[model samples]
Target chain A: MSKTVEIRWHGRGGQGAKTAALLLADVAFKTGKYVQGFPEYGPERMGAPITAYNRISDQPLTVHSNIYEPDYVVVVDETLLESIDVTNGLKADGAIIINSQRPKEELLPLLNGYQGGVYVLDAREISIRALGKNFPNSPMLAATVAVSGVMGREDFLGEMRQSFQHKFAKKPEVIDGNMMALELAFNQVGC
Target chain B: MAIRERLSGNEAVAYAIKQINPDVMPAFPITPSTEIPQYVANYIANGEIDTEFIHVESEHSAMSATLGASAAGARALTATSSCGMALMWEELYVAASDRLPIVLALVNRALTGPININADHSDSMGARDSGWIQIYAESNQEVYDNFLQAFPIAEHKDVMLPVMICQDGFITSHGVENILLVEDDKVKEFVGEYEPEHYLLHPTEKMAVGPYAVSNYYMETKRAQRQAMLNAKQVILDMAAKFEQMTGRKYGFFEEYRMEDAEYAIVIIGSAAGTCKAAIEEIRATTGKKVGLLKIRVFRPFPEEEIAQALSHVKAVAIMDRSEMFAGSCGPLGAEVRAALFQAKSQAEVVNYFYGLGGRDITVQDFMQVYDNLENIANTHVVTGMYDYIGLRER
Candidate 1:
């Protein structure tokens, strides 16, 4: 458990929260770490709140259960903070990274007095400035990596660049936008 | 050298299918399992493998077409979950009785009554008596490995029965994890080719399949099927040995973790066994308790004697089931394991627990509590409750 890092994602359906979790796993795996990425699935519905999880460890992971006490919690959709307990069972020593433009003071109360270090990133701003669309998945993923220290910034960026090149091969321009979004988000989290 | 890759269980199984390049795959879409065929279809469309992909209207047709192809001396398979498997109920028996040796990639999910789509063993557990050789996986890697062995085990001359390779739906089927894949040429050589001795399309010999059997012949046919299942216990081990030699992973009828000197143990199947293993490690580390886990890999041949021998040293054992049998006493795994322990004349106090039914989550904490209960049971020698439920809410 000491070497393992668990993270949970809170997002609406189609927000790519699940995708972000998987990307984290993919990046972690590239660094030779064992990883698990999965979503708590339900009936398909648009804008419905969804949860996904990640377990990154140096040793091989055998546990298949949901993360009850995650070291970090990522809120992809800030509105989910009102409906879901985003900090439930979150470690106090760890932190919660939220994709919001709101000031920290406004969002802190919404966390039900969570004592964890709360880091805020304007993912919408970052994605819009970089990718010209509000695709928060990239920024949120980068923020989680920076906050959790699952991998160094250089390793994360290198792996993500290769993945984006492969994923967006047909549209070469989209790769730079995504990389920019990751960089903007990574630096904004102050890592 | 093994290829290091990350893939969901479905992807891993489909990758194996691509490597094996079976002759035919006739399948209909079902939740958690639809991705298996979808990936295969993508493979075929991309010219990666030339497997004949048949898009069927229903799971019934899926199984029927697969049976037809296999009987026609072609390697055939299909994938399904939950009600889709129920739809193929009739063909399940036909494939086994006719000895088609077809393989089925099953992602275990709950059957519909109230209508839910999540991970559970109700579907495969329902087909426990369908004459198919059932093998359950604890993770994506295990499912990939189990599927690689399915063809060799099913196609064995001594055990020519259909095999169902099962994994927890959405749990392993959808979750992405790190896995080591054997090289394609090695997989090709390992699975080899399916060459049936007798078939409907034989050039020289005339053959018939699924003919009407009277009561006298039917009984013997069933007995032969039983004998085939009994033979599978050995074939499974033999194939596992070969698989381990090719790769570095060792598999058996059941995996015994920390069981050598345990006073309390848990017998479980499927993905939750991984969670139980995590719990065992924590309990042993913190409390210095001798807790162990017996994760069953081969559920069909049951491995009765071996399981009893493995748990013989334990003072108490909790047999956990992810599916409810509605039999008033215990679930399917519990019943079979209790029977095995009984026949072996072991005095281990046993309690049956029904957990994770209908996609419910079983956490490590829940498992830790189960171990705590086992300790209490072993110490008191009084069974407060023999049949119980975990993660169940009280009214």
Candidate 2:
């Protein structure tokens, strides 16, 4: 494992790229890990492409700049693959997890010359099946953790439940569905 | 042992305020710093602390209310960033001239005109001559710790002046990280209670606060204010030493990182120090160059002698500035360090570089370039332009 794990999330503005990045850091902080989670800020609208970042480390993190050479990338909306250079400046040995129904081989063309682990999952279908909605951020986050091995699947699930409980306090059903979707994606992610 | 929590810089400052639980807090919202007041408001509403928060209409009124509460002998505080702080421009001088010891949690952002809401030192640096003490923090922990220590420095008997504790706007203000929090009771004991020798609310003493001084007294009043700021240099050192003993987190006017017997060094401020440290680490690993860093934690009361002494040993020093000073020399920091080195008559060839204006990203390679320039000067001692900008799209 690297001394620090830098993760970049590519997704549309309305999607939970910011949420996933921040939630991952929040949970990491709870486990006594040093973390930084921030979205690259611009005057972005609802559906525009946006990026968020995370720096998770066992020791104190001294780098306060944005992550350019991310160790892992999570593409919450696979549509972003066509436009943004999702693998730009990504480390050669880094891994990527894409939330897509398409096979890993199908997504390989988009990440040319990456030469890294590629994990694919039908995160949207998983979330829709469990939550009756199209939102796949929580499940994509779970997939990210499972594929990157930055943290244990159980640790991710436990933190996801706690985060959802606090965030969706008034909607108990929403919280349960998010938890279910997170676990499903975690179990199903594969290259 | 301290309690550990995940908090953004604003949340950490709010937590410090919660522990201080000062008598009054006058607040108005501005980007980056807006969350600070929001969190404090929530803290007040939740009964976590008993700070009387005055929701003012504008940033000017926020500072005015803070001055009023402080003049009335209450420990008062406020928060603002960028334009909000600019709005309080006139009052910033008043808070210091009146010798009111108030703590302003300033989230450093770019000032208006071309209008960007990102991290820069222009906001606080613009007020560098406003007779207020300024301290810059590099991390969320320093943000919390600096806020706690600022009170003693400003309120000391010899230095009854206002202080601004600044952290990068969205960089530190909105960015989340793990922070160690001092126990509430321990902080309370350390800060103690606010006791001003003279106050507007004093029952037996008839006195004036923020009064108009005639020509005869105006210069002397200004001089007294200047002297107070000068006296604060030592007071800050004393307070930081005491605070370090309490929390095991040492602080000073400036921090020297890996500077022993170094031939090249860079002096920087605020959040960018972390990035430079990373660059220095990488450079030292690959090239084995003897590079070091001198990050100025206290910008005001400039720490001229101390900083000059520290950088005097290096062969070539580059004072990095986040904001532009268009005056041909580097920005404010570069300008001052040049003057300080002149006073010390140090032979180090100094250059200035301005970067990250209006939130431009400065990468590790960019800093490595700065170090390379310094290394060249150290070897040949041929100085280039007085100043240069990093990562600019120049022809």
Candidate 3:
């Protein structure tokens, strides 16, 4: 409420929700905002549902507890909605964004009575077309930024490009594909 | 010229080690603390530092290798968590009694029974009397700053002892936060060159470190080490002051948050202190109750006098311990604080609460309950003479 944006991501261990949260923190930090990004470690294994959290703000943060009331919840894997309470402790004014091919209205019942905005995006198609793989991390991040307005779509694109350049220096195609997927996902989110 | 960065407690410590560029680092991996060695190994691989990264097989070997290097006069470090710390239990005393001045980046983990990889003070608290200069941190920034200060304190001519720069296992170690790092040049200069006066590998000086002493010499040697540790109290303060001037982040034996003119206060350590501060703020704002906190930063030397004086005027106090001492009287922090009070002759009603064992969550609400008990004690001058656990389920 004090200009801090808390977001939680629900996804499998290898699906990059944790990566998305950290990338957002790094990019948001580059944009001159205070940020915190960390994953709750359980018995981590591939395909096991894992949770990652973020707190981004203009001022420094002091509270270090797990985010029980998140401003935005991103379900990086739509299947997580069935097994996990994705909307647990969401703020009344918060929004839940799901990465799915389904319509926003169709996923409304899966919200567990959350009276907030529901947004969905066809992240798989966008990822496959842009990156030639099904890694939806960057797209989901872009979609999260788009729906939450935590970061401007244009600013995220620019920052993501700069970060990806360093992370994928040997493979320019990977950088280009991630950038393209982010932009397409930014456009694809429907509130 | 300090640089602003965002890093977790583990990364911050690793970055400090990167800047210090010690002579050797022999390490093994453990939960929550594994990231520290992993990061340092990466730095060495990238040639950011030329410090020897010895990939030891176990925590015991890690300590042995560290002592082996430090005795040879090469500045060394290693890291471990809960069980790993326990495995190195025997060597902890050797590192101290040998007066090797090794700086250990200990990420505090819970000593297992049911087995836990979470945050607790049991690991470090168990070694509080192991002659290591133990310092606890409440945040990532403190962890970084403390790691940078450790070498100076331990290597001081007066206090030739090992130092453990400890932060909570996953609570601070894994939690990312914004931090200001000192300029690399400034840190390197402050830690300075480690030119040992007498070491096993000295070219001209002949000396044997860590030789078994008979009863005739052991007590005197221990007396000298004890004096050195006592001298460390001032050395630690001096280093903290110097660190403050360089980085503008002042540190002390303890942090008394809003303790002035308070009738009810809670003393705690590490990450849970962050939550307690929030609860204190809420109690102050919503209930008009003046609640304060005394968060312990340096645990080994146990700033008894300063802590006693700080809580002298408070009406009722709650000392929260993340690890249970199981010592019939009280937990470590509680027993120490009670002793400090007895010495100071303060009449403040004090109670002990053992919480967050095995990394059970100690939330703002949990602290709120402690505050309520403090208030009740404040009114009636009575306390429930019972050991308490925060949020522990009774079967």
In terms of lDDT, which candidate is stronger, 1 or 3?
1
**What fraction of correct interface contacts does each candidate retain?**
0.88, 0.75, 0.47
Question: How much is the TM-score of the A chain of model 3?
Answer: 0.95
Docking model 3 quality class: medium
Judging by DockQ, tell me the better candidate of 2 and 3.
2
- Cα lDDT for residue A61, candidate 2: 87
Highest DockQ scorer: 1
Full-model lDDT for every candidate? 0.93, 0.88, 0.87
Query: If both were scored by lDDT, which would come out higher, candidate 1 or candidate 2?
Result: 1
Higher-scoring candidate on lDDT, 2 or 3 = 2
Give a tens-digit lDDT track for model 1, residues B219-295: 99999999999999999999999999999799999999999999999999999999999899999899999999999
> What TM-score does chain B of candidate 1 reach?
0.99
Candidate 3 residue A27 C-alpha distance from true site, Å: 1.5
lDDT of 3 by residue, A2-59 (tens): 5889999999989999888888888888878888887887767999999999989988
